[model samples]
Every structure is written in C-alpha cells, then in structure tokens.
Target: MGWLLLLAAGCSEIVFAVSLKFNDGFTKLWPSVVTGISGIGSFYLLMLAIRTLPLGTAYAVWTGMGAVGVAVIGVVWFKEPADWVRLASIMFIVVGIVGLKLTHAE
Candidate 1:
C-alpha cells in the first residue's frame, strides 16, 4: 500500500510537471488548475506513504519515478529528444529505485 501510494504520488508529480509547461507560467487557466490539483494530490499521497516507509526511501523513490516519468513525457509527448545518454540515465534511475526497494526491508 505504501509503495502504491508513493508511485501514485510520483505519477501525480509527473502530471503536474507536464502540465506546468502548458500552464504558460500560470497565465493559462485550465492547465494551471490541473497543476495545482495534481501538486496537492501528489503531496497528500507522498505524506501517506512516508507514514510507513522510511522518509529517505519514500522520497527517493518518489522523486526518482517523477524524474524518469517527466523525462519520458518530454521525449514522447513533447519530442524533446532521447539519445543513448538520456535513455541510460533513466535506466540508472530505474536501477536505483529497484535497489532501494530491495535493500529496504521495512
């Protein structure tokens, strides 16, 4: 349950981050609203997860997932670019997340 909440938080973060680009620095209405709602929901879930999971582990996974997710969003939806280096970096984040989960027994 904690892991699921953390993953959801991470996804919410990604959603807010992508919406931020469309927010036009808060000039837009709908995107801005989406960003605000997602940001709040992200933190709420993050807090829920951190209640049971170690703070460091929870935060690391949350941010790691969000980073990878946003980067993929950049490449896929925004066509930002995805060479080998970028792809490898994302894989590293995935490996790190796996490692953290494995090492954290609680």
Candidate 2:
C-alpha cells in the first residue's frame, strides 16, 4: 500500500515537473494551475507514503522516479537529446530504484 502510494506520488511528481515547462514561470494559466495541483498532490502522496515506508528509501525512490520520468519525457515528448550517455545514466537511476525496491522489507 505504501509502495502504491509512492508510485502515485512519483507519477504526480512527473506531472508536476512536466507542467513546469509549460507554466512559463507561472505566467500561464492552465499550466500553472496544473503545476500547483500536481506539486501539492505529489507532496501529499509522498507524505502518506512515508508513513509506512522508510523515509530515506521512499524519498530516494520518489526523486529517482521523478528524474527518470522527466528525462524520458524530455527525450520523447520534447524531442530533447536521446544520446547513449544520457540513456545510460537514466538506466543507472532505474537500476538503483529497482535495487532499493527489491531490498526493502515490509
């Protein structure tokens, strides 16, 4: 359950991050609203997640998810660079996320 909440939080974090790009420094209307909502939602979910999960592990995984998710979105949706080095770095973060999850005990 905590892991599930963490996952949702991670997804919200991604949305919050992506929305920042469209918010135009909080000048935009809809995008800025989305940014505010998702950012708060992500933090709330993370708080709920930390209630049951280890704080350090949950925080690390949550941040790792946000980083990897935004990087992928940048490459695919924004047509940003998809160079091998960047891809490999993303993979490493993914590996670390997986490692943390696998090692965690309920």
Candidate 3:
C-alpha cells in the first residue's frame, strides 16, 4: 500500500512536470492550475508514503521515478531530444531506483 502510494506520487510528479512545458511559465492559466494542483497532491502522497518507508529510499524512488517518467513524456509528447546520452542517463536512474527498492526491506 505504501509502495503504491509512493508510485502514485511519482506519477503525479511526472504529470506536473510534463504539464509545465505547456504552462508557458505560468502565463497559461489552465495548465498552470493543473500543475499546481497536481504538485500539491504529489507532495501530499509523498508525505503519506514516507510514513511507512525509509526517508532516503522513499525520496530516491519518488524523485527517480518522476524524472524517468517525465523524461519519457517529454520525448514522446513534446518531441524533446532523445539523444543517446539522455537515454543512458534515464537508464541509470531506472537502475538506481531498482537497486533502492531491492535493498530497502521495509
């Protein structure tokens, strides 16, 4: 359950981040609203998840997963550059997330 909450929080973070591109630096009203709401919700869920998970592990998983998801969204939806270096860095983030989850018993 805690893991699920953490993953949901990560997804929310990704949603907020990807939506930022459309926000036009908060000049666009609707996207900015969505970004703000989702960002708040993500933080709320992250705090809930941290209640059960170790702080370091929870923070790593949340940020790492969010970064990977947002990067993929940027590449697919926004056509952001998908160079080999960027892809490799994302892969490293995935590896680190997996390692953190595997080693975190609680």
Please report the candidate that would top TM-score against the real structure.
Answer: 2
Tens digits of per-residue lDDT, candidate 3, 17-100, equal 988888999999999999999999999999999999998999999999999998898899889999999999999999999999
lDDT of 2 by residue, 1-106 (tens): 9999999999999999999999999999999999999999999999999999999999999999999999999999999999999999999999999999999997
- The residue-level lDDT of candidate 1 at 71 comes to 96
Considering summed lDDT, which 10 consecutive residues are worst modelled in model 3?
Answer: 70-79
Candidate 2 least-lDDT 10 residues: 97-106
Question: In the order shown, what is each candidate's alpha-carbon RMSD?
Answer: 0.8, 0.4, 1.1
Model 1 ranges with Cα > 4 A deviation: none
Q: Could you tell which candidate, 1 or 2, scores higher by lDDT? A: 2
Error of 3 at 34 (Å): 0.6
lDDT for predicted candidate 3 compared with the true structure: 0.94
Instruction: List the global CA lDDT of all models.
Output: 0.95, 0.99, 0.94
Per-residue lDDT of 11-89 in model 1, one digit per residue for the tens? 9999988899999999999999999999999999999999999999999999999999999989998898899999999
- Clash pairs, candidate 3, are none
Give the per-residue Cα lDDT of candidate 2 at 34.
100
Steric overlap count per candidate: 0, 0, 0
